[model samples]
Target: MQPALFAELRRLYAAADVAGDAVQLPLLDATATARALLIEFPQASDWPSVGATLSYLADELALPRPALSVSAGGAFTLWLAFASPRPLPQLAAFFDGLRVACLSDLPADRLRCHPLSGLATVPVVPAFDAVVERWSAFIDPGMGSMFISEPGLEFPPNSERQAEMLAALRAIDDRQFARVMAQLPTPPQAAMDALPLAGHFTDPAAFLLAVMNDAAVPIGERINAASALLVAGRR
Candidate 1:
């Protein structure tokens, strides 16, 4: 994280005035502090610690639960993402263990988790449910459909998976896919209007190309595409 950015977040959290129960104060303070740090920190491995801290604080404050994710890369460059359902104090303890596993000095090994060579499945817990629910909320329902579900969890996909999904869409029978796409509900006009590219694609090919070729498009547009694919795939 950039020093200036971190400092600014610290200031923002510090400046917030309390207007609730005194018991809420410490938890609120901790949540703000952890959130600020998490937002500022780019390293995915560090997320557990920050998430755990914030979760602990949130619990203490009796605040409505929020979701969290800890994603990392593997030996062959495969990505891994995990989430928790509701914030739990145990996650903080788990974060402590993750911290030890991720040594401070090593960059590549830091926070890295991967699938074992012999293992065909990745491990997951109930917490990931909350993560998926919250993540889905952030995305359009169309995009949210792209999320893949395991026995216990759902997650936003990585770039490679996104590419593969796009490829699959290309391979699908066009008329059938179009019919399916038609059934998908249109997203909010506000979200669609916010982007110049969305709500304007008359053809699936154009939509796919816009998603693949347009690096300059806003992040929200990309998110929309992902969500749209999720919804489109369902059909």
Candidate 2:
């Protein structure tokens, strides 16, 4: 096993917040001269499509075709082992093109890449099982589930506050509800408008629920909405 490659993969797994034992090492090809790159996604629906697209991309770019595998976790592992050493530029270009191809088909936030082995001059036995054992041991179950919650992001609607706001809104008539909504700040107004519910929700609580759950909405707007809800509830 290449120590440097293992270290890099370890770092990437942590940075990407990959779920429990989600990392997969690149498998050695028939000649055992090269190891493949690993790519993972959050969902399984697109894995086969991505694999096909990658194969097409490799042919179009005149790059080495990668051996593709799928994991239960919905990751697509692409292997492109070379029997002989290749130029760094050649490898870099291939990976770059692969990245672009993936981005064109999937959301950028859902993709991750991990380099398992460096360019090799000679065939080396890929330590796939060993790598898996090491990673399985390295993962901490206590760490909890992985998600995209960034630091400093303030999400709206903690259970207690949301309940209070909902209760308050429920007590109001439509005229009063409209008045309270009108008093909401511009940022929350914009956020609410961006939601699919927007003006369509008959209940204020449901509208807030939609705003709270949308990951695409700005955090500030969500917070603003929560605050507005609290203030409106008081009225």
lDDT of each structure?
Answer: 0.30, 0.37
How badly does each model clash, as a count of residue pairs? Answer: 10, 1
**Model 1, total clashes:** 10
lDDT at position 221, candidate 2: 42
TM-score of each predicted structure versus truth: 0.19, 0.31
Candidate 1 TM-score, true structure as reference: 0.19
- 1-235: candidate 2 lDDT, tens digit per residue: 3344344333322222222233344332323222234454545455445556555544543443433333323234443443333333333334444444444456545554433222222111121233223111111112112211211112221334322322221112235323423442333354335654345788877777676455454333444455456568879
Candidate 2 wrongly placed segments (more than 4 Å)? 1-35, 62-65, 86-90, 116-235
Model 1: residues with Cα > 4 Å off, grouped in runs: 1-201
Which digits, one per residue and each the tens of the lDDT, describe model 1 over residues 1-235? Answer: 2233223222322223433222121112222112111111224334344445344433532222222322222011112111211121222222233333332233422332211111112222111234335221111113222222212124543434323332221112234323423433333456434544556777885685576334333333554464465467779
For lDDT, the strongest prediction is 2
